[model samples]
Target chain A: MRIEAVALRYRYPRAASEALRGASVGAASGSSLAILGPNGCGKSTLLGALIGNIAPSSGRVLLGGRDLATLAPRAAARLVAFLPQFERMSFALSALEYALLGRAPRLGAFAQPAKADEDAAYRALEGAGAADLAGRRVNELSGGELQLVRIARCLAQDTPAIVMDEPTSMLDPAHARMVADAVRALAASGRTLVFSTHDAAFAAYAADEVSLMRGGSDQFRGPVAEALEAGRLASCFGVPFGAASAPSAFFR
Target chain B: MPRSPDDLRARSGKVLLLALAGLALLAFCLLAGRYPRPGLLDPRLLSSDATARAIVLGSRLPRLAAALLLGAVMAAAGNAFQMVFGNPLVEPGFLGVSQGAALGAALALVAGARSEFVVAGSAFGFALAALAAAALLARAFPFGGWVLRLVLAGFAVSAFMSAGLALVKYAADPLRELPDIVYWTMGSLSGASWRRLGFAAIPALGSTAFLVAYRWRVTALSADEAVVRSLGARPALSRALVLAIASAGVAAAVAMAGAVSWIGLVVPHAARLMFGADARRSMPASIALGAYFAALCDTIARAAFPGELPLGAVTAVIGSAAFVALLARGKVPVAR
Candidate 1:
């Protein structure tokens, strides 16, 4: 499914300024879009708008040419999957069990997941390259292992598009490379993918296109190579950038 | 790691074993009473001895059924409560359901209402009202997350209900009403009759069925709020619905048993220990195990000595010890 945020504007409850001021971005199916920005650049807010979690004060989000606000939650979820930056698990659930939760939108209110749902969860684990972790308790997994399992959960959702907030943040380079590989694989699977990241090198390696943001507005949107140019990076982040300091880019 | 198929098979087998064990315990409880010489009554006695038949059919059967229902409902509801609130310490009565029921029963008694139906009915009504008040109070609080606000609201509601109960006790006539109120607080199943069991069974059993049928949804609610929403569930709406259903079942059980303790607070923990924490397995396990624990405890409460003991006291003594043992064994996976 193609998703588009057409000039979204939003404000927090007691805040003096809008968090999202006419920020817009879009991603077509079978492509990946990386949102790059400095701190407080409204990337997360824009992602929230795309997923229909936060209502925009004005403008709108569109999913495949249909107004996102018109769809019910289940219908919307069926069209798009989402992964937040952080999630807390209250109990010790096996990886397979946690992934099975993604089948919820397809089941009835009182229905249990059938064999097909279990198969989907297993396939999702394999897709995320964490199939070996299926029976392990999610609470006991290391950070990178947990992130892969979480990505597997998003895959188990089986939606046409997936959105993630900071999918590779807070990880060492090795773990970050693993997540970047997962992202590349997901993009290769012909699904619409959107993710936010502060690592320009990682973004350039994994994303087909990049959307740069500063002060709650899109400053630039183009092919990753053009968006990552030193002048553009310096302007977007309000810092000097030398081509030599662009950092070690992860493998494609 | 074992595959998903093996995990499913193992969990199912464990649940089936628990159900069978529960059935065996029920049979033993039915036969082991003070009547027929303080031990397991020979199964052949029902055909030959008339007094044994009356004791088994007239008294023990209904009481045993009430105890089983009380256990199953409280344990299942307790599991739901813990999952929905995202707090391991939460039990069915944490939201003032027990205190509200106690206050309702005390007020009915002080109002000169003598019938068991009237007293239990009053309790049932107040228990639901207490849940509503807590929810409303939680919504009204501007600070804290949903779980924190609800917990705080429950604490305040319970304190107020306790104060109300104390005032009711102070105003009662010391001799006639005081002892009855005191006895009610300790909880007992001696009043289990066929009619009373029928009255409490409908709501309690219905609620338990819903929780078991919707077990995975309960597990989903146990995740972070943002995760639940991303999964296409309205966390606030779903949480409210689960809490209401679980609280209603708990209120019904409390009305029937008069503030039975420990079963609701501890049985779910045991179920999670025996089975994994997935509600798919632990929920049914909790129901079966709860019935067994309650029946076994009640059998001891009624048959261990000359005079009947309070069911609440017996369960507290046993449940606490089991909790300690579980802790000593380690691997609880409880979030502190």
Candidate 2:
């Protein structure tokens, strides 16, 4: 589904300043858009607004030409799936069981997941490269394995759009690569992707479009190549931006 | 994704077997009591003898039903508490439902309200009040997350309720009200009768049925609130609803059975170990297993000695032992 944030504004209940000051961004249907920003840049807040979690203080959000506020939560979820930041879960559900929970939006209130739901979960796990981890307890999984399982759950959600917050932020290089590959596949599968990340190179590699947010406002919004300039990156993050062609871009 | 259809089939089969075993135990508990002494009564007696039939139906049936209801309700409430609070150590009383009920009951006794209806009603009211106080307190402390804030608020209310109970006890008649308060706090089901069971059944059935029907959604409690919300769930509203229902069931159980310890705390854990932590499977398991545990405990309470043992004492010993055994076996995985 097309996601349009039309001049959205938000502030925490008791906070001194607005978290989002008239920020606007959009992603076309079946395309990948990355909200690239540094810490405390309101990337998470913007994603929250897009998903209708944080109601915009002013302006509004439209999901597929309908006011987002008008849709019921279940209907919103069916149209746009979400993958939140990783949770340090303590409960003992298997990866497969956890993934099957994605079918919750589709199931009736009193119904449990049927065989078709389980099959969908299996397919999602396979797509996420977590098929081997299906039987394993979620809490017992390593960081990479857990992230894969989480992504598999998102896959199982099977909506028209997916919104994610820092999908690879907590991962090691190898795991981050795995997540990056998964993100590309998700985008390629014709689902609108709205994600947040700090890694410019990774965003450039995965996202067709990029919107750079700095100091709680949109700094740049365009094609990834245009948004990844060194001077603009330096200003956005307050760090020297450099391109390294030393046979590896993972560290950058 | 990882599970086989055969494994699921086997589990369903196991559930059936467990249900059958639980039914048999309930029947056995009906015959095993101190009145008969040293051994179980003849099954033929249930039909042939009038006084025996009256005793079995009027007296034993109620107590047996009480045990079943107490176990299932408390276990189900305990499971919901743990899920909504996102804490493994939580129980139905962590939010002060039990203490609130005890305080309300104690006040009723001290006020010379001897009727069962008044006492149960007061207990139920206070139990719901405690939850309200916790919610209000949580709202006041908006800096933290829901689970953490609720936990702190509940602890505060629990302490206050305990103090209130103590004060009521200190002011009561030493001989009559003191013993009643003490016995009620220790928890017992000996007063179980058809009348009391009927009173408790409404809330018990309402809560358990709701929890069972919504068991799948309970999984959302273990996730981050953002994730829960993103999936089209209102975490606050959902938790509140579950807590209300669960606490109502707990209030009914406490009002009926008298502060029965350990079952509410340990039964859900046991269910999780035997089945996976998914509420869908473990919830039904909790109901069945709780009934079995309560029946066995009640039988031991009735049969082990010439006089009936307090139902609370027997369950405490068994529940703790099972908890320790579960830990030793490494099935619980309760990391500090």
Candidate 3:
């Protein structure tokens, strides 16, 4: 599915300022778009709008030419999946059970996941390279391990487009690379991926394009190389930037 | 774990075993009460002595069924409430349903409506009202997330209803109504009869079936709202529907039994301990376990002493003790 947000405008209730101000971005199927922004730059809010979690006050999100607001939640879910930045489980669930919850959109409201759903969950776990972790309790997994399991859950949703909020945040470089690799693999399999991240290195590694957000709006959208230029980086972040000093430059 | 078909089978088998054990306990309670003597009533006496037959069939049977029904409904509703609210500490009691029922029954008693049907009906009606009031108050509150708002709202409503119950008790004639009010608050099945049991069965059992059938959806509600929303389910709508159903079932049980405690709070914990946290397993386990706990408590309440002990007191003592033991074992399964 092709997800495009066209000039989304959103303001939190009781807030003095808007969280999103005319932000727009799009990602085609089999391509990946990385949204890069500083803290409080509305990256998360824009992502929420695209995923239909938040209704944009003055703009429409289009999923394959269909207005997202016009579509039922189940229809939208069948086209796109989402991964939140943070989650807490009330009870202990096995990794497999957690992943199987992704099949909920496909099943009846009162139906349990069947054998085929279980098979699909295992496949998703394997695709994300976390099949061995399926037996582990989700609460017992380390931060990186849990991320892989969560990614597997997203894959199990079996949607063409997946939106992730900080997919590689709060992880060591090795774990971050693992998630980047999973994202790359999913993109290679023709899944549309949109994610927000501070990891410029991961973005350059996995994303085909970059959208730089500033002050609750998109500042620039282009190829990653041009978008990550030192001049653009310095202006976007309001900090001094050197080619050698850039994290992505060093990693590259 | 990669739960195989065998694992699912094993869970089903465990539920069946629990049901069978509960049936056995019910049978034992049937014959082991203070019937012909202080001990077990002879089967031959049941066949030959008309009084013995009448006592077993008329009084003991209905009372035990009521106990079983009360425990099952409370536990099942507790399990649903805890799952739907995503809080192990929450139960039907946390939602003001129990307090509302208590207040309704107290008011009915004070109004000189002495019949069981009128009292239960009033209790059910007020219980639904309390739930609706809490929901409305939560919606009107401009602060906190949905669960937090509802929790605060329920707390306020519960306190209000409890105060109302106290006023009803205070204004009653001490000799005529006070003792009866106190007894009702303590909860009992001593007044259980066929007519009353029939009245409570529809909502209680129907709600339990609804909960058990939709157990997975209930578990889905416990997930983060974003997750539930992304799965094409409206978290707010699903939560409201499940809470309303669970509270109604609880209201019916409380209406009949007059606010039995502990089954709602403790039985689900035990169910989760024995079965995994999956509602598919824990829900049915809760039904069986709850029936057993209530039946056991009521049996002891009636047969353990010449003077009947209060069912609520017995459940509190035993439930608290078991809860402590579960905590000491360090495998409670509840996580943040």
| Highest DockQ model number | 3
Q: Report the lDDT tens digits of candidate 2 across residue range B1-336.
A: 346788888888888888788778877888876444467778787788887788788988888888988999888888888777766677888888888999999999889997988988888888888888988998899688888888899999999999999999999999989998888888888788888999999989899999999898887666678777877777899888899889889889888888787887789888887788999888888887887798789878877788878888999999999888877887765535
Each model's chain A TM-score: 0.97, 0.96, 0.96
Query: Model 2 over residues A45-80: C-alpha lDDT tens digits?
Result: 999988888888797888888889889988888888
lDDT of 1 by residue, A1-252 (tens): 788998899998777999898998988888899999998999999999898889999998998999989999888888888999988777888899999898888988999898899999989999998999998899899888999899999999999899999988977787788888888788788789999998788898889999999888898999998999989999999898775644564844
- For residues B1-336, write the lDDT of model 3, one tens digit per residue: 356788778877987887788778988888877777797888889889999999999999999999989999999998888888888877787778889999999899999996889989999999999999999999999988899999999999999999999899889999999898899889999999989999999999999999988998887787888999998898999999999998999999999988788888889998987787778778988988999899999999999888899999999999889877877886665665
Candidate ranking (TM-score, best to worst): 3, 1, 2
lDDT of 2: 0.85
Q: If both were scored by DockQ, which would come out higher, candidate 1 or candidate 3?
A: 3
Show the lowest summed lDDT stretch of 10 residues, model 2 chain A: A243-252
lDDT (0-100) at residue A58 of candidate 1? 95
Question: What C-alpha lDDT do the candidate models reach, one value each?
Answer: 0.89, 0.85, 0.89
lDDT of 3 at A87: 87
Error of 1 at B49 (Å): 1.4
Each candidate's root-mean-square deviation in Å?
1.9, 2.2, 1.9
For each candidate, report its DockQ versus the true two-chain complex: 0.62, 0.59, 0.68
Residue B213 error, candidate 1, Å:
1.5
Docking class of 3: medium
Name the runs in model 2 displaced over 4 angstroms. Answer: A249-252, B1-5, B45-52, B333-336
lDDT of 1 at B151: 91
